[model samples]
Target: MAGAVTTVTTLSNEARPKHLTEPRPVRYLLIAVALLFIGIVVVLPMLTVLLEAFRKGWSAYIEALKDPDAMAALRLTLITALIAVPLNTIFGVAAAWAITKFKFRGKNLLVTLIDLPFAVSPVISGLVYILLFGAQGFFGPWLMDHDMKIVFATPGIVLATMFVTFPFVARELLPLMEAQGVQDEEAAVSLGSKGWRTFFKVTLPNIKWGLLYGIILCNARAMGEFGAVSVVSGHIRGETNTLPLHIEILYNEYQYTSSFAVASLLMLLAIITLVIKGLIEGKLARSRHGQ
Candidate 1:
């Protein structure tokens, strides 16, 4: 019995290291599979669009670039993004501050409502705007009487984009703020720092990266927004058209090359956003490490 026990113990010890080492093959296999899927689904499609954009050479590119309607769409998209992202960022910060820094009744419900856009269909959101602002819809008659327009106009587009991007900044900042706790704020208060000063000097520095990340995401979504904007935009050519809408128009008109070109432009913007976000996150990480 003693001899058998000794043999089993020796075998168990020998097998343990091999068991740990053998699992590495499974890990590598999973990583390779993930990469393969990403390449096939995302990388390949992006490459295809890039190639198609340049398919017609520099002259076509220049022509598309010079198209007044295309320029207008680009301008409108930028303008909407400029307006919407800042507004959303402000709202997000306020929402995050309220929800994370204070405890109140129905707090969870409020947070859930703020995040409702994530689950609500963009089409439905657009329709709701239309119902509220359309000429024949609920408040539409009053708005018309007051000579105000919301649907089928720039303001409508901005509002729709705002609705869609509303939760981004808050979602990004909420957890970060919660994790940071109110200790710093309390310390600042104890030191007699004013609210705004404490927020700018203490709170802002800690979560700036996360805030910026959310802003970038908001801007990207605002720029690329299609479904909701389309529903309310009325596709009024240079007047109300955005880049994504313009791309759709081009595609429908069988301007395949131009569609791809515009798509490539959007893709480039997305890549730039991602790069900026990565840089911000890296800086944040390094800052934390240094601290």
Candidate 2:
């Protein structure tokens, strides 16, 4: 009996993957390689942006950011995020709830459409809006007749941003909502709770962290989006240019310090987003474990 038990133990150990049983040296080497890669890809570029932004002096860096065009770009970027993030968050939550908590016709189609933005390139996404709204395009005459402009205007910029960042929140929540299942929602319904009550009480608490995570990612993408916004913005300097487009204009005009200074703002935003995302992820992990 003891020999049989020993054989079972040996077999179980052997069934584990070799990588999981690697030597300490190999483990340390892998960790070192991962750290090196992150340093090269992420940390180095951030440091470079900061270093170059203030290369001249603190005064120059401050002056660069205080430029009228730069301030305009900053405000435009903020307005875009303020409009885009909340709208996408609402859409994402609705899409996630519909796809996860209920079953209906065209479910697969709904999911595919949710993923459509990710499958398409940013530049192509911009061009699609232009084709629909450009002065020479399909709705051009109708829009002109109505004296309404959608392309190469603020509306165009917002639309492009919405398209590019559409997938982030939904994609984040889909798998999470799926894993939580529908039992809790069903219980709430059986207990005489209304739809919105159940959602606000039971559903929201369960998925809040995942929702926040998705919102952060969505906001980050919206603010940093360049290709799509650039194509539709007409780069009208202070009028339509967002921060990324403004940075490009500055760089093109050989204003390296100013460009880096503007770039630094984006870099700071990215860093803050990453930090918040990490904290939210930690909270999410704890909540899941508690469940």
Candidate 3:
């Protein structure tokens, strides 16, 4: 008994790692490489944006952001996100529910179609819209007769953003909802719960975190989207330009500091998105642990 107790104490006292630990030099080299990589890829660009934005002065930066064109871009971007994110959120939840809960033909094909935007180039996606709606394109004659504008307008911009952001929430929720199974939902139904009630009380609570995660990604993509929106937006100054497009216009017009100032807003938005997403993930982790 004493011998067993001594062995147990010795084992308990040993601070052995589960895997073979690297040498101090190797471990340090890995950490240095990671830090250097992050500095080069992430830190440097952010620092550059900040420095350039303030190069002229705080007054200059503020003035740049307050420009009429910049203000329009900001407003258009907010409106676009306001429309696009919620639309996609609803579609994502519905699509995820149907795809995860129902047995249907062409299921894999539906998933692939949902993810098709990711595989397609953004520039090409824009071109496809233009072809379908441009003045010389397929529906152009009919639209002209009706005096409808699709390409080079707000509608086109919203549509392009929608296409790109479509898959985010659905993809995030699918696996999670699948893992949760339908047991709870079926039980809810058997207990005389209505369909909407069953969904809100059972399904929504389970996937809300994943849904929020998807929304964050979708909002970021929608706001920062350039190539696709650019193709159809016509970059018509205060009329159609989104923030990224406005930054390009500023840069081309030789207003480098002001352009950087606008870019800084985008960077700030990205940081905020990341912070919120991290908080949501931390909460989810803690809730799972408590359960």
Q: What TM-score fits each model?
A: 0.89, 0.90, 0.92
Candidate 3 structure quality by residue, lDDT tens digits, 161-182: 9987778878877767777778
Comparing 1 and 3 on TM-score, the stronger one: 3
How accurate locally is residue 130 in candidate 1, as Cα lDDT from 0 to 100? 95
Q: Give stretches of model 3 more than 4 Å off.
A: 1-19, 286-291
Pairs that collide in candidate 3 are none
lDDT of 2 at 75: 94
Candidate 1 residues 1-291, lDDT tens each? 111111101113444566567587787899899999999999999999888888999789778867899999999999999999999999988888888888899998997888788887889878989999998899999999999999999999999999888888888888778877788888998999999999899989988887887888889999999999999999999999999999999999999888888888899999998788767766656545544
Clashing pairs in 2: none
What tens-digit string does per-residue lDDT give for candidate 2 at 8-98?
0111334447766778798789989999999999899999999999999999999999999999999999999999999999999999999
Best by TM-score: 3
Ranking by TM-score: 3, 2, 1
For residue 204, give model 3's deviation from the true position in Å. Answer: 1.0
Model 2 global lDDT (CA atoms, 0 to 1):
0.88
lDDT of 1 at 235: 96
